[model samples]
Target chain A: MKPIGLKDLFVIFLKAGLAFGGGLGILAVLEEEFVTKRQALTREEFLTDYALGRIVPSGTMSALAADFGARFGGFPGSVIALTAMVLPAFTLSVSLSAAYVYLAGTPVLALLPLTILPAALAFIVAAALRLGRDITIPSVEALLAAAAFIGSLVFRISPALLLVGGGIVSMVILAFTERAENPA
Target chain B: MNPLQVALTIMVLNILTFGNGPALVPLLEERFVTMEGILTVDQLLYAFAIARVMPGPANAYVASVGFFLNGLLGAALAMVAIQLPAYLMLPLLRLHERFSDVAGVKRFTRGLTATSVGLIFASTVSIGRNAITSLTAAIVFVLALVMAYLLKWNPLLSLALAALAGLALHAAAPSL
Candidate 1:
């Protein structure tokens, strides 16, 4: 695939910005769009960018978009991607916030969110399932997931702590597994 | 709701979240309500609920909360502050190229990625407890799961159907 230009970056991120509901949940779709469809970024490039996004000190979606934009269009591309990535949600959020404040008093308005809630809930659940099938292949990866779920669910542990802990735990496991294999 | 305070507070919240938006909703609610008293708990939850209906990540809800606190300017400021970190850290992508291929980093990210997926699952449970209250709600949950995951329907459309179901359910069981 040829190197992507600023226009491509803007259009791609804008489409993503309009499509994703879950924050990190959009990574899979992004891989599909950029890697499989556009052939702009290879799977390896996307994975590296995604890992960088996870370790970076911002939102994963924003970090990934910024990195991809930088890759395609340098600093200006990053700016365009970030702006396009945010425009749709920002518009929707501000509009909804304003509307809710003015018009959410009626009984019908009250039930609107209640009705949307279940579907939204299920949406995330399905996303988790989809991501699970894609990422959690190894037993250790599965263990990390189970630990994360139980820790967050039962102990009220924060997700940040769980993610950090899982990283450390997986690192330790990898070290041990490698050592065991190379015991010469 | 001072704009500066709003900006600074949201900036700090984004930093604390470390880019994981959904995980911080409960914390966001507590602080917005109890610490600042800018919004009621119900109001905060409603803001989060409707956030799902929007296209961006759920964190875009922060913009809505900003609006709830102040208005358009507040929303704009909060959005910038929350998103600033990512752009600010763009230089780190260069550093990532140097170390991303290291074995331990690879292993650690494998863990983090899997764990992140679990966090998404937990988020569903958290939201499900609120949304799936009755048999009707359960049906919506199941129906949405099938439509979204198996049949590949647009999520917005599924949510629309759920809203109609909500209205119908309300009409049928007025006391509920």
Candidate 2:
């Protein structure tokens, strides 16, 4: 397939942004369009970008877009892809926030919180379980997770500190293990 | 909230957030809900709901929270702050060999991922305190969790059913 231009990228992401469902839903659409349908990016390349996006900072969805954009269209492409992907949702969220400020207490929309809160709780819990299920018990990663949980929830420690501490511990362990393996 | 302060806080939050927007929830709740009390838990949950209902990333909820705190500028700053890392990753893409080859990056990512997962788990309790108010709401929460986690149904689908259940419960017991 030929290289995809900026306009095409924008249009594709815009369509994705407007599509129903959230981040994962948009990812499926992207995979279909770029990997399966257009064959612009091979499945391997697409998956690598997706993985790298998750590894990097920011939300995975936006990072995926930026990574793909940079791959296809350089810096301009990255900006355009992210902007298009988020434009629709940003507008709606902002508009709703504005409306909610004045109208939240009103009877017709009163159930908004009652309904959304529990559902949101469900969403948060499910996300936690889904992510944690992959972690092996008694591993360093698990230890880090347990430590972070206790520190943040029980001690109210700063999350930044926990994150830095976890990363450093992981890096040190990895360094030591690698050195032990290659003592030539 | 001051716009500059909001932007700074979001940038820090973004750095700690690994994988997804939801990972940032615990940090956000601590900053906005628990520490400063800028917004109530219900308001933050509503922002999350709006982000879910709308298309794109769930992280866009930051914009709603920003708007509630300040206005359009706040929303814009939050959006930019949250997305800043993606753009920052662009230049790093050029260093693919060195970047991915570095054991440090992989180890750090693993650690961060673990930390994020733990925080996400912690957030369930923190947010649940405010979210799970009555028995009916708890039932909705359980059902939604089942649909999303066990049945592997779409989150949107679970939320839709939850909304319906909420409406039904409200009608039955207005006092609740």
Candidate 3:
């Protein structure tokens, strides 16, 4: 493997941020770019790595930065990857904070609550639909998703509980189904 | 509270909130007004307004509050505290790949992803309930959703159109 340099870090981070908006989808984007596009790893390999990224603590982007760096250029590669991934958004946030201190009190600010909030809601809904369509849910998985949605919305359950419950339910179903298919 | 305690609280809050920068708003508002005695409700709200109007992550807005309370070091500490989780977690996550082949683990990730989508939907419902105060607002919200889902419009463009619609509605019916 080639030594991962600053330029590689910058390219990966910029691409990850632009494609996935620096969120949960970073692994998918990275997989498509490096593994699928470059043919460095197979689809199965990429999916397994992505799954590992999610199960671990911390954000998916952080996991991707570390793993990708390690894969490309060992420990130093990991540093480059992580730095590139975070620097753009972190710098932008700091700069924006400086400007906000000046303009926050203006009456023009009221316009935003009336506009951006609604759009943000719409974005969330759209994201849910898009993700649901991508994942091939079996009947049991579908039930878990529906249950989690209702649990959060109607019961006003903590998101953490809903997530943990869904994970347990999926694990049970996956275990039973696998056993049925490969009984001794 | 002392600066060290404040810094620790901010760091823990940042990790718990999970989403990028916007997740810090409510937590900051509650802490700044109710606990820290650093800013009033009005000041916190104003900080929120300023944070949204300007670019960047919402966590940085807390630095503005820090600046108001204790000057340059306060501002720097607040920013560092909020961002430290991202910096620290990135390198440590490299070892995750060693368990990639585990079947049970993969199932858990799929479940978590689905649940995350559900949580996002719940949040959407709550935000929409608060934000769609008028028929015009509801219409703009629906239109933005349609543009995003059906027409594949860029989110920035949808946001721009919604803002224009809000401005027009406010002009047309000043009562709202």
Clashes in each model (backbone N, CA, C under 3 Å)?
Answer: 0, 0, 0
**Candidate No. with top DockQ:** 2
Tell me the tens digit of each residue's lDDT in model 2 across A104-168: 66985667656767888888888788778879998888999999899888998987788888888
Docking class of 1: medium
TM-scores for chain A, candidates in order? 0.63, 0.80, 0.69
Error of 3 at A76 (Å): 4.9
Report the error of model 2 at residue B70, Å: 1.4
- Scanning candidate 2 chain A in windows of ten residues, the lowest lDDT window is A108-117
Cα RMSD of predicted structure 3: 5.9
Summarize candidate 1's per-residue lDDT along B137-174 as a digit string, tens digits.
67667877787788877767877776677668777885
Could you give candidate 3's per-residue lDDT for residues A1-184 as a string of tens digits? 3444657766866666544333544565677667666666678766655555544344445655666677777777776766665554445444544555556778765565555556655655666677677566656666666776688678867665666777777877788888899996
Model 2 TM-score on a 0 to 1 scale: 0.89
Predicted structure 1, TM vs. truth: 0.73
Cα lDDT for residue A184, candidate 3: 68
Name the lDDT value of residue A137 in candidate 2.
93
**Candidate 2: residue B170 lDDT (0-100):** 80
| lDDT for residue A2 in candidate 1, whole number 0-100 | 69
**TM-score of each prediction:** 0.73, 0.89, 0.68
